[model samples]
Target: MAAAERRASPRRVRTALVALLAAFAVLLTGVSAEAQQRPRTVLEMLFGGGQQAAPERPAVRKPVVRKKKVRATRPARQKKQRTQAARPKPSGQQSAAAAVAAPASKNENAKTVLVAGDFLAASLADGLSNLYADNEMIVIEARTDGSSGLVREDHYDWTEKLGPILDEAKPAVLVMMLGSNDRQPMTVGSRSLASRSEEWVRNYEERIGEITEATKSRGVPLVWVGMPPFKFDRMSEDMVFLNDLYRKGASSVSGEYVDIWDGFVDADGAFVYSGPGVNGQTTQLRNSDGITMTNAGEDKLAFFAERAINRLLGTTLAATGALILGPDQLPTIQLPPIGNAANALQAAPVSIDDPSLDGPDMLLGTGSAGGFSLEPSPRERLVINGGGTGGTEGRADNFAWSEKSAAVTPSGPPIVSRGSLNLQSVRESGGLKPPEEMPTILDAIIEDWSRENEAARPE
Candidate 1:
């Protein structure tokens, strides 16, 4: 019974100790949590803390008030001033704008060069404009449709439009470049004709003739720029054919035809993407598509047409800014009247081989000239007179036979020559000794037999 009671007492004490530990842990947790909730004061941080601390008061709240919106009396003026101050200076922009606008400004009597047809014509106009940008008397007016061509008259008929454009623009010159987009089948009244067919070519040529006639009737100078070779072989072939037609049409109307084929082709007459440009530098002339031209190509195209335009307009006008004088206006050049025919200086006809033809009475080394006697040179003596020193006796070149006997005396030295040394002379003079004769086959055999006999005879 005592053991049971002892055990129960220990258990009871253990229970009481556990309860005290739990209660102490709860109290510590509560104090730590409360300390965390409230911020440390300056005094607490500087010194130490106690259980009875001062409580934290609630933050004061301010009253909410609304302010009325104030409107400016001169808002527009203020805004304008603000905008003016904020705006950036357009110095560079203004200069760039002026540069662009400067090219467009021209004299009131500037001659208009009307460029008509397709996109190629438009590019041509751009090039011409750039070329004549400095010349105030020239202007390039482009009336082109990018997709228009002679084949599709319904879309844009150059035949009908050219007359009106000529009258309206009153152009000094009419430049046309088309047929690039005309490779497709062309439509006739009710029947569609295949591209490049005999019938189609006839019809196409007729349209070209019509445009040519219109320009001729209007009294405006016409310039038809032929198409350049394309990357495609078939397209290039068609262009060649079309260029021929253009040439014929232009010639019929007395229009100038500018052939730009050689410019865009290689040595073998194939299309080239890159070629010698206007300045003769190798550059990319055609675009990647090969159908369209790059800026350099456009300039090159203009270069060909520029010549024809200059010729028609009179080169003096383009080159020196001088007026083209007509036949009547040209100053007559009256050459001085020739003196009496008898007193006139005349030249006599001389033979081609005559040495006197060079202004001298005789050859250079022939004889005296102007009181100076010139001796004949060695070359002149040999070639002209066949005169030179004869070969020495006993020399290789000396072919003359000697009358002396063939037998030579052993005591006397052989004859010595000046040009070359002979073998006999060399030996006789003691300068060289005669070589010992080599043993013949019979002699060698006999010697060998004699040696064998001697050995056999007991040596």
Candidate 2:
């Protein structure tokens, strides 16, 4: 009975301890809630003994003033996503950037002049390099490939070659000359076109456009040097046609077309083998074959383009009045040709009509003693062969011919000699006979020829 009493007493003590702990915990929780709900003043915190003050009225918690909930809009999310995407470049674009990375120019202080084309262009470059040898600002880069032309892609492909050159050199100006060798047939894919054919010309022009585009893409100015005349007339004609194409192509790109043909030709427009050199001294300018120029000729060729290049480069002479040409372009002016001491230029008089002023007969007609004639020469008459009895095989037709009155016909019309007949009186008056009463011109030619033959016999 004592043991049972002991167990009940211990159980009662444990219950009382648990009840006390529960009351203390409830008090601590209430204090914590009150402290958090209301801020304390310094005096209250010091004197209030950490006890929560009772409110005058039952306190109602102010509505929690939380920031207004912001709902994310679809457009804003989309915009955020786009900004993030733009911050990072796509993988494909990164690969492209790697592939197309360009090479920088090696020399910036020196203005690079890219001279490229066939043999002629090489010669031009040589001359220009020599010309600018002392020039500190210019650097001539010669990239000529002889035997290369627009037609023969197998030899060299300029379109493919130019990009790398442009990237590496970054030339300020591009000078070229190529058509001298491109006058042959061109084969495009499976088809073939004859030289200078309509189709060939189109293809050639397109190739030129490609070159111009490649140059202009890099912001380089182009100068296309035209081909000089060839020794053969037919080849010269072809060169003229080619020059037309070059001019058109150059003009399309706002490029300069240098016409060096006149510099290489004579006053009569014939290909000259000898001409004034860089020093104005007469020198052999062309090779024996007449196709290529000599050193002197090449320098002369550059003279034609020097002024233009100087303008483009903004080059000017120093305070001294001098030429931009090699050292000085002004040649020593020589006195006029004088045949004899009496005919010296200093002694010669400037008369209104000086007989000494020699020129072609077209400029100086024969003296008034001989009657001048404006009649059509026998050579100008067209010889038309027909059944005629004028002792001639063909009938000449400068005037009308009639077979009805062949026997009694006079020469078609009187051959009016100029300066001797009044044309107005002749046209108005009945000076011109009818075609029926006029003989064919064939008889007149026959008589003239026979008379000339007689005059020449034993004379």
Backbone clashes, each candidate? 0, 2
Per-residue lDDT over 343-449 for candidate 1, one digit per residue giving the tens place of the 0 to 100 score: 22356777899976678676678973332124554455568989753445454544445522365333555445556768666668988766899999999999999
Which ten-residue region of model 1 has the weakest summed lDDT?
Answer: 74-83
Q: In order, what lDDT does every prediction score?
A: 0.79, 0.74
In candidate 1, residue 402 scores what lDDT?
59
Judging by lDDT against the true structure, name the best candidate. 1
Can you write out model 2's per-residue Cα lDDT over 282-390, one digit (the tens) per residue? 8988887888877777777777767656666556641121335553544654434433332122563578786657655554555433333344333333344333223
Candidate 2 local lDDT, residue 389? 24
State the weakest 10-residue window (summed lDDT) of model 2. Answer: 76-85
Residue 280 displacement in candidate 2 (angstroms) = 2.1
